[model samples]
Target: MSPMGIRLSPLGIGVFCLLGLGVLYHVYSGFLTWRFSFLLGSRTGDTVDLRELLAVSVKAAELGGVEVKAVRESNKLNENSKGKTREGADEKLTRGDLLSNKKMANLITSSFPGVQVNTEEHLSEEDKEAVYWNRGIPNEIKEIVKNPKFVSSESITIWIDPLDATHEYTENLVNYVTTMVCVAVNGKPIIGVIHKPFTGYTAWAMVDGGSNAKTRASYNDKTPTIIVSRSHSGAVKDVTRRSFGNQTKILSAGGSGYKVLSLLDVTGNDQETADVYIHDTYIKKWDICAGNAILSALGGHMTNLKGEDIIYTGSDGNEGGLLASIGMDHDALVEKLSSKITSK
Candidate 1:
């Protein structure tokens, strides 16, 4: 009995100490992991900050080499779209024509210096090539684009590379246009941001349990307003007029993010009803994510024409067609429109 006390060999002591150290390390790591998960995990029924959302959109835009100045100009121009025509008088350009138009190409090239143009005749081709050339729009994006489950839920998370044509930035300035990043929850758009680097304009919205999701910055009661895409087809106007009649005033806007933002009343009356609707005849996840987040945060809904909730962050990321509306009547409106639109 060496000292009649608990005696251990050096090896045993070393092993004991090692085990203790390992336990300590694990405990520390577990704590850190939990902290991180808590921060990143989506919380329901919480108000999201709009300023922070805008910051993220701005960062995403900068990554694509879009000039902040151009984004700002685009935002300003969007703001001026009161009582303007949603569709241009000229015949609609085919996918090939829009992608290869010399003027459009020149604008894109001048705005972004290092981008290359790979024209295609079809929308699918343009989308595929964009994903290949722009790493930001990853395979995940393509998967989501093809999948339908993601856009069918009430609460959804959406990710986007607003300007996926960073390389085309040098070749086409307009290619550097801002894109939308959005997250919708409970069939409502809660978080949204628009990053337009070329114009130095970034806008974001977060819904905070309000009956009216429109932002205080751009609300007006004098106008029975509607928002539609400027670059896309005027089919939305046709559908809207058919549903709401000619009494509703429609406004054309560029980019999904801008159109969504316009509904917030950035320069108008807060009490005015700013109903933002989207036909999204050619919708993309990246195009609507940020705007979705903003609207959801404000307690508005963004769904497909079928009245099904849109989801994001799934294996397949497809939303059949987008239909957004502000206030309690969103579901009713969808129901009413679904009966008429074959695309939904």
Candidate 2:
């Protein structure tokens, strides 16, 4: 048959589509930012999912955001909780509370069965002791601990904070609250996810290469915008001024994740604003890990005030302090910060 007379079969069309997969790869993965916003993105999610842990985190964040925001307008953020446990007027605790550790735990466990979860909130002292003693841990969780360091421990924890910046969230500063999850092996972060529910933004990265994404963010700012804790006040301002000097602008913010988000934020009409996040106080590992991954993926850095990377041994008491930044002078910022004395 002549070429014009030959009709293409369905199998031939499939061959053509397969040949053009490079375009499909870009089209499929390029919209990660958009796909994650709606939690409609398809991804693998098993305890062994590794870098795909990013998508599991996005799912958990969606669940947490939905659960938390549902009660915001009706419950008034349970102002009477006094930021305490869910009791009294906070009994239902489903209000505008940003500390939805349990909800996230539930969502994550349900979604990623066999993956160990540790959040900032939890049970009674006796129950805590029981969990610590492994008096009640399920066999599935026990089987996942491949690390020798965790053999004596409860499990290889996916450290999490369902919602950070509870105070700012209660005060209607919703953007500052975020959901975080981190996977650590041998006390080092291998995978991390930082999800900002209010803005529908999520970012994640891993030390290994299962992630199908890379970063293209600009990493240079002469006069950087510095971010500090909005709710907690300390010598952070003075230190920022002293380190970056009068040229840099200071922004009071809440949540370690939120501050890092500001660095990669592109909501500004002009372009993305990249800044440095400084915290002189101790923050939990879950709070910082997800941000660390995103920053690292973008060729940025985060470390203790002593210019050391956190080992993530799972401690809430972080005395090392935090310094995270992206852009041209990242190393210089770290160098200068190393010398700046922190009174905290």
Candidate 3:
């Protein structure tokens, strides 16, 4: 007789506790993925800034168990015409509805005042409050604010892209859109987090951290795969074609942030995911910073076409092209490309 209930064997009690722990873990993981996925999903729209984040969705999509409305055309313009009218889209009063890059920048600075943040926009006080009230903040970020000891680095730098792949987003390629945040220490990336709003896929990693399902990438095929921009291809295509020739296969994608993660896609299993990522076009720092961090955390490599490191300075522009790979011989690849293309 244990209290008012029948007594159980010691082994039975241990088994029950383990089962309880497992259930608790499952619930926590689901809730985390759902919250972040929904946060990213809610702010996705055709235009810039100003959005009201409710359980509402203009597109018919399910994220983390919540039903979202399908994204519909605003009807102000037709598909036949390429037009954009910003005559009266003022949203000062409804600023809280949007998840602008400024808002995210403000929140990160607030969370870690000691750490430096480099973002695309200049953040004001109002933007900080907007993000806080709108639930755009993350749990791990909040925890880091409370416990600095959780991260080993004495000093850290943050790079944020509130929205990546705007071209695809405007072109109705919803699945390619992503929200990225990367953390670096001593000018080296240590943490990478990527969230796909429409797909409800959130993957994160840390350098030297324990491995997860997406940690490993393998190439067992005879033909190597390379991912480049879907929309912008000319110099990269011609240069790479002449460099690698028909020996390697090339694929086009939308976002630079997402392209780096494709190296770790794991869908083709560990054996068939992409092997190399190259871009000859101009790439802003915010575009690939997070993806590069995530790739580095997973033991991948990224450098300029000259085979030099592209330093991460969040606000400024970068020189030369990029070469990123998962466990591939980067220097050898660059040596082959250098013969065909000149490093800028």
Candidate 4:
């Protein structure tokens, strides 16, 4: 009434102040509950939920695998040579690679809008569509881990190998082929999924979070079995001979993903098993990142030949060469072969 506004009496003003205080208290209580939830691993303020990411990655890998298998069954490779590898092996690409890459990229992009994705296939502008899949978390991974929240560094990077072992796939070595996906945070791989399209086998793991890869029954460390690339042997056989002696039982195979899965006792269409997987040439991160995460989850180690850890910073390649082992003493093995097997 004094300044063209209705005036409130003293009692009315007091009542208004009491109501404001009640609202403030309610808001403060809600904040406290949210803080408590964050501390208990239920809510992540800035951190991404690795469980959700893992589920999405599994779907992406499987979808990619479907495309790869369908193309192989249809017998339309449309293969083109992507030049030759340094080791003189024919580097090949096919229509299956592109289609698989597109499906995986679309699903991941739809689930995670702004996340950085690096894939092995070269895609056209028309292949970059975002397609969301309406599905819940996979039952196999629903209660796999106690705390599924990834509270570590928030900088996320996804690596995809749509059709690993493309040359082998073209040669009808379906056992060596795999579709792979890996999630690395702060240049460290924490989640991995490898799917074999031909055999319908999938192995996944999250660091500090469990893995479904079973241990091999015949893992002999005394005279360890080593697997090397058949296409790019390049002195690895000699290195194994020097390190583990002449009867070390060295097996040659294709596909980095297949070699890694062999360590996990995932014998594919054919029976293949190994205690160690070694590569002595430049290899891409997509080819090895999923294996790294899976091995890491199972208390194994995957590092460079010089006994150094490989940092996944979304680069094109790693020239340190590969040394991965399970159950065996990794440090001792590294010391033995680091001097022998080198990228030349």
Candidate with top TM-score is 4
In angstroms, give how far residue 73 of model 1 lies from its true place. Answer: 12
List the global CA lDDT of all models: 0.47, 0.61, 0.56, 0.86
Q: Rank the candidates by lDDT, best first.
A: 4, 2, 3, 1
| Candidate that would win on lDDT | 4
The 10-residue segment with the lowest total lDDT in model 4: 36-45
As a TM-score, model 2 comes out at 0.67
Which stretches of candidate 1 lie above 4 Å from their native place? 1-58, 62-158, 164-176, 182-191, 205-214, 217-223, 268-274, 315-319
Worst 10 residues of 2 by lDDT: 128-137
Sort by TM-score, best first: 4, 2, 3, 1
Residue-by-residue lDDT tens digits, candidate 4, 30-138: 9999865443223355565788788889999999999999999999999998888888767899989989999998888766755678888876787788687554677
Q: Model 3, range 91-173, lDDT digits (tens) per residue?
A: 11111112335545655444344456766545656656422233342454333333222433234566766556655655556
For residues 90-116, write the lDDT of model 1, one tens digit per residue.
222222222322222232223222222
Assess candidate 1 and give its TM-score to the true structure.
0.49
Question: What's the TM-score of every candidate structure?
Answer: 0.49, 0.67, 0.63, 0.85
